[model samples]
Target chain A: MFSEWELKRYKRQMMLFGDDGQERLKKAHIFIAGAGGLGSPISIYLAVAGVGTITIVDMDVVDQTNLNRQILHFDRDVGKKKTASAEEKLQALNPDITVNAIDVKIDESNAVKLVGKADGIVDAMDNYPTRYLLNDVAIAKEIPLFHGGIRGFYGQATTIIPGITPCLKCIFPKAPPKEVFPVVGVTPGIIGTIQANEVIKYLTGCGELLTNRLFIWDGMQAHAEELCVERNPACEACRGITTKTPARTKK
Target chain B: MTVKIRFFARFRELLGTDIVTEVVPGTMFTSLITTTARKNPAGYAAIFDEKGAFHEFVILMKNGKRIELTDAAKTPVVDGDEIAVFPPVAGG
Candidate 1:
C-alpha cells in the first residue's frame, strides 16, 4: 500500500484511474523479455507505478554502446549483466515493488514457464527468433501482450489481447529474415513509453489500448501514421484457439 | 488489374508515402519490388541496399495477409488486392 505521501505523488494518475486502477496495478505481474533499449523504460515505469511484480529476462552484458539508449545502466555499470544492473536500479527506484532479474536469453525452453507466470507479457527482445518465441508463447498461454519495435528513426507499437487482438504471427506469419538491424536510442524511448502506457491503461481499465492498429513513427520526416491490422484465421498462433471467437478490433 | 501496395513503419521511410497502386498482378510481389525500385530508385533506396536484397526491416503482405518469404512469389494476388509492406517492429 502506498503511503499518503506516496498516494499524493501519484495523485494525477490516481485521480484519473481511481482506486480501481491502483488496485489493478498492484495486482498485475509482468514479464519483460529484453532489458536493453525497450526493456529499460518498460521495466522502470512499471516498477515505479508499483506493478505487483516485474520479472526481467536478459542475458546480454552491457556495452558502452548501450549508454546512449539504455538509461538504466550507467558508464560505471558497463560490462555488468543488463538484467542484474537493471534490477538493482529498478528496485532502488521503487523498493516497495518486486523485481525478478533472470540473466539468460529467453528461448523455447524457458519462454513457456515465464509467460505462464504472468498476467501479461511485454516483448522487449532484440531478434526475430525471440520475438517469435514470445509471440508463440503468449498466444499459446492466452496472455495479453504489448509489442513495440524501434529501428533507426522508425518505430511501431501494438497490443495483442491473445485470442482477441491479432497476434504478431497474424501480422507477420514468419520472421522478416533479417537478424541485425539499425536503431536509434530515443526511438526505443518513444515506443517503450507507449508500451508502458498500454500496461497502465489495461491495468486500470481506463481507456482503450492500441489493439489491431499499428502505430508508427517515421523519423526521417518526423511524422506519424496509423494503419489497421487484422486478426488472421490462418495465424498459427491464434488459429483454432476456440477461445475468443469472432475477435473484434477497437477502432 | 491494380494491386494496392501499402507501406508502414520503416518501409514507408525507405519508400516515401504509405501506398502505391500499380497495375501489376499479385504474383509479382517479389518481382515488382526490384523492378519498381529500379524504376523509382529514389522512392525505394533504403528498402533494398547495395546487395539488391530487402533491407532486413521490410516485410510484404498481400490483402492484409503476410507473404511468406519462401512462397513470396507464389503467395498469389488478384485484381484490387491490398498488399501491405511493413518494417520489423521492436518496442515492448
Candidate 2:
C-alpha cells in the first residue's frame, strides 16, 4: 500500500523492480554498523532507496579528519556525535523511511540487541573484531552480512549468507595489523556504494548476490575482479552451524 | 616449465603482479614465490619474514585452491599453474 507520494518518489527505480520490489524495499529494515567512511554512503543510499527502517550505530564524535571520507558529517559536525549528525542527515534525505541512529559501541555484549529485527547487516566497520562479531550475529540469525573494507586504493567486499556461503572467518582467518591507514575519499565511496548496491539487489531479488565470491576492487589499477571463495567446514566462527534462511516473503 | 604468479594489494604494489617465469619441473611452491619475490628486497621482506619463510598472515592459493603456509614448501608447482598471494587489507 503505497501513498501517491511514495509511488512518485521511487518512480525511476520502480521501473526496474516494479511495484512489488518497491514494496519490499519499503518493508525491509537494514542495520548498518558504522557511521564513518563506508557507513556514510551506505546509509545515505539505502535511505533514499526507501528501505523502510535503518538502524545505524556509532559511538564516536565526528573528527575533523573524518570529513575527508565520512560524507555524512560536515565541517560543522566535527565536534558532534556521529549518530546525531547521521540521524539528522538521513531523516532529511528520506522523510518517508524510519532512521534510528544509535550512539553505542557494537560490542559482543550489545551487538545482537542493537541489530534486532533487521533484515540484513552491513559491515561498514573499520576493524575486523567488530566485523567478526557482526558475522557471528548474522550466522546466528541467518541474515545476510554485506561485508566491505577499504584502505588506500584497495577494497574488498563479500556477501555472506550464513550457512550457504563462506563466513568472513573462512575468507580471512586472520586480521591484518591495524594501522592509521591511508585512504582517499573515493576508496570508501567506491566500496560503500558496492555494498549498498548489494543490499538493494538482495532486497529486490534483482540479481546474483556476492555470495561465495570476494569482490576485490583495486582503484589504483581500476581493476575489478572476483575470487572464488568457499565455506570452510571447519571455520571457527560458524563450524557445524546450519542456518535456515529467514522467510523473506513472510509478510 | 612455466607458471604464473599473481600478487595482490600491498604485495602487488611491492612486487608487481602477473609474473610469468620459467622454473624447473620439480620446483616447490615456496621456492617459486621466493625466487620471483627476491628480485626486490622490499618485496621479499613483505612476503617473507627474516627467516625466509612466508609471513604467517599471507594467503597463498594454487590454481584457486588455498595452499596452507605450512604446506607451501611441500607443495610442488605444476606447469601452467596460477598461484595467487595476497595480504588482506584491514582498514575502513
Candidate 3:
C-alpha cells in the first residue's frame, strides 16, 4: 500500500520490520505531552520513523533558555509558540505523516479530549502534576504510557501498560518538589529516545517493552541499569482497572 | 553486619553511592540512612526534613523491594542488604 516514494523513504528501517510493521507505524497515533527537552527528540524521532499521527501539546513560548535542549526551535523562534515551531519542524521531517501541535496547558478539563484515540501517550512533561494527569488519561483509555524524566546528567524511563504494569502513581506516589530543575541537552535526548523507542516497540509489537522495570541512566558514569518495578495494589490512579487486553506478544 | 547503600541521581551526587558500612543487627532502615546520609549535611537535609524524618518523596528499597516511607522507621536492615534511596528526577 505504499507509494513509490513511501517505500523508498522507509527502505532501510522497513528491512527490519517489513511492510506490515511499517503499516502499523503508519496507522498509529501517538500523543506527546511536551515540546521542551524531551518532546523535541521524541517527536522528531517519531515523525521521521513515520508514526501516522503525532499530537504534541505545549503552551509555552520559545525562550532563549530553551534552545539548549528544545531542538525543534531555533534562534529565530525565540518569540514563537512552541507548538508552531514543533509542527513546522515535524512536518518538515516527514511530509508523509500528520503532525497536530496544539498550544494549550494540558489540564484535567481537556487532557482526555486532546489525546483522542491515540495508541500511546508519551510522558515528556517536566512536572509531576501533569505527568500524573497523563497517567490517569492513559489508564482510562487503556493505552500504554511511555514515561521519561531527566535532570542534569541523570535520567529515568519506564513503560506503563496500564492495568498490566505499575502506573506512574504506583512507582512514585509522591511528586518531588519542583524547581527550575537543572538539565543538560543529552539527558532528555537519551531518555526521550528510549521513550520513542518504547512507542515504536509497542505499536509494531516487536521486542521486549520496558514494562515492569525502571531504566535509570547515569550519563556522568555512562552507566545504565534497571530496577524491577511492581504495581501497587493500592495505586490511586489505576487500582480498580483490570487488564481487558492481554499483554502484546513479541513477534 | 555490613550493608551496601546505593543512592541514585541527585542523591548520588550529594552522597556518594555504593556506600558499604557496618550496621548493628537490628538497625532500622531509617536510622541506617540517617547515619549514612549524615556524612554530608546537604545530602542529609535533602532526604530528611528538619524533624529528622524522611522526605515523603524519597523512595527506599531493600534488596530491590520497595519499602514504604511509613514503614522505613520500623523496617530493620540485615547483613548483605542492598538498599537504594533516591528522589524521582522531575525534569524533561
lDDT of each: 0.76, 0.90, 0.93
Best by DockQ: 3
Candidate 3 structure quality by residue, lDDT tens digits, B8-38 = 9999999989999999899999999999999
When summed lDDT is taken over every stretch of 10 residues in candidate 2 chain A, the lowest stretch is: A242-251
DockQ result, candidate 2? 0.75
Please report how far candidate 3 places residue A25 from its true position, in Å.
0.4
What digit string (tens of lDDT, one per residue) describes model 3 on residues A105-147?
9999999999999988999999999999999999998888999
Tens-place lDDT digits, model 2, residues A150-216: 9889898999888888999988887777779889999999999999999999899888788888888
Looking at model 1 chain A, report the run of 10 residues with the lowest lDDT sum. Answer: A242-251
Error of 1 at B7 (Å): 3.6
Candidate 1, A5-95: lDDT as tens digits: 6687567878888877787788778989889899999888999887888998889899998888888899999999988899899989987
The alpha-carbon interface RMSD of model 3 comes to: 0.5
Model 3 misplaced stretches (Cα beyond 4 Å): A247-251
Q: Per-candidate TM vs. native?
A: 0.83, 0.96, 0.98
lDDT of 3 at A210: 96
Report the C-alpha lDDT of model 1 over B1-92, residue by residue, as the tens digit: 76666666655655645445555454566666666556466556656667666655566666655566546655566787777767666433
- What is the per-residue lDDT of model 2 for residues B1-92, given as tens digits with 9 covering 90 to 100? 88999998888888989999999988999999999999999999988999998887788889888888899999999999999999877777
lDDT of 1 at B21: 54
